[model samples]
Target: MSDVSTRVDIALLGIRGGSTPVHRRSGAGPSDDGHVLIGGFGAALPIRSDSPYSLAGNKLLLDGADIGMEIEPIGRPKFYDLQTADGVSYEKIAKLHGSNVLATTVVQTCIRYGEDERCRFCSIEASLAAGSTIAVKRPDQLAEVAEAAVRLDGVTQLVMTTGTSAAKDRGARHLARCVRAVKAVVPQLPIQVQCEPPGDLATISELREAGADAIGIHVESLDDDVRRQWMPGKATVPMSEYRAAWAEAVRVFGRNQVSTYLLVGLGEDPDELASGAAELIDMGVYPFVVPFRPLGGTLAVDVDHASAPNRDVLEDVTRRVAKELQHAGMLGSDQRAGCAACGACSVLSSAGG
Candidate 1:
């Protein structure tokens, strides 16, 4: 299949999850990275199989018809079986995302988890309730687990994301500590840290100094009205704050090193989303456009608003944003670390962005 068609297929798979898909039994959650190697590229896609597609052996079937493609789900890594010296399981602390990237929710609880304040699509705390992950992961524990992952799994990078803490730094401080500890143990491992835009832009520099190679200051949406509807609490931060944070992060982490997630399936207009992506590219921020999966624990799933965007809508928005990325010479692969670089959750890379 061509790149556009492949991207379209991937987008559809995310919307309508395939059945009997290959994946490891033990990995990250409440939102796990269901890695499936698709097409001939061995491109690892992070899928949440909640939709109508399925697999028969290696062939991918969409709505029971052959997709005319082969896919293989990634198996759980050996490192998950190991435990820390203190007896905490490695898998509880962090899990492999995609094929080789170790990822963790450094702090699983968010301040905005309340009904009126929470992002409708977020499942950060749900994993904790499910006993799939711990509430707080110490810096030292993260360092220890990361070393094991690198040594045992040949893991190339790290993604450390945290829910918004009560502190004004929005958990950047804790993320920095975790990054420092991990970098100290494995100096060559590239690390990506994710958090909300800090109240003090200076924290961006602190994260860089602490050894984070890339940063994800995810806004999820650029349309303020949509933000208010889907993320009432986060929307209060305002677009200006996000812009300032992006500018500061770009200044500290350098051009393509800063990325943000712009979820496409929300109610944002396609033209507006694409335009926002263009503006983000101009600011040296990579807009990681992702299909909005209706995770089971999210408010969207409960309200019956979890439908994925139409195929045409997904493809149009992605192609437009990909064009912007290409024109700006901002390939997601250039990040070297983080969600944008992973390319499993989004098809912009396949679209030649």
Candidate 2:
């Protein structure tokens, strides 16, 4: 195997081994403050499930150790038990993320899925496979879920991300419709929408006009080689296309309101990742630096993939980027909605937001 792949595999094995219950402990102390800490990383664990070996474990590791920060997981929303008139569970439609953001995948299945084009890091269909959610959520269902998550869970924002559809718009139209429906119910709620850069840039205006508060057009990696290896199908779309889409998103969403995901440990050099982040920030976008987690059932898991940049690397990159964001006066607080604002999945929010 190549050097980068070998490094990533080792990292993945370490993470899996470290997350075992025997090796885990609650990060309890005066500093705990309801947050869970593991392996020098800290984040709020979900109140509903105390099992420390799941995604929450990985999140805590990334937060406390990687970013030198602490974040609290979002508690169970009151809407989890509620069902729509048609008998759809609200929680399955849209679940709360972080402290006050409701997130959902409108279309669980992607056209690129099962094809060689699938992004290796993604397990968009796994939730569906485990029966955690329905294959597709109707616009009305999402609006209903959002309303309850806000009223009961104290959710203040919403994030709608969709699997790619057959259309070139890549399900942006459905996302726009969902955003509109949810906003109609809660006009003051901040809503963020995420999707691939569509074949038509006009869909961006459609989303903004539909009342979305912000947008995330994630190009997980700017390094073409890493992109091809990590997200084969998505990498087919040129970086120039992503740049144009980001420019238009910033134009519509305004400054930091536009964001993208930049996963560390994808074989991209640390300096290169930081420099790419700088370019994105310079363009009025937030580069959300996240440590790659190999979700169950993803191609990553099948290949036993892992992230190479450890906590030290993550901290260095986040600190530098946070400093840049501060200089630009672009706190995640300035964002109306989305992961950057929730700040739970990544420690960058705690680093400086």
lDDT of 2 at 344: 51
Clashing residue pairs in candidate 1, if any? 18-53, 18-54, 19-53, 19-54, 22-73
Model 2 Cα RMSD, Å? 7.8
* RMSD of each candidate relative to the true structure: 2.8, 7.8
- Give one digit per residue, the lDDT tens place, for model 1 in 205-315: 999999999999999999989899999999999889999999999999999999999988888889989998998999999999887765656788877557767778888
Tens-digit lDDT track for model 2 on 18-54? 2222111211000111232333332423222222223
Candidate that scores best on TM-score: 1
- Among these predictions, the greatest lDDT belongs to 1
The local lDDT score (0 to 100) that residue 93 gets in candidate 1 is 92
Clashes of each: 5, 7
Evaluate all candidate structures by whole-model CA lDDT and list the values in order. 0.81, 0.71
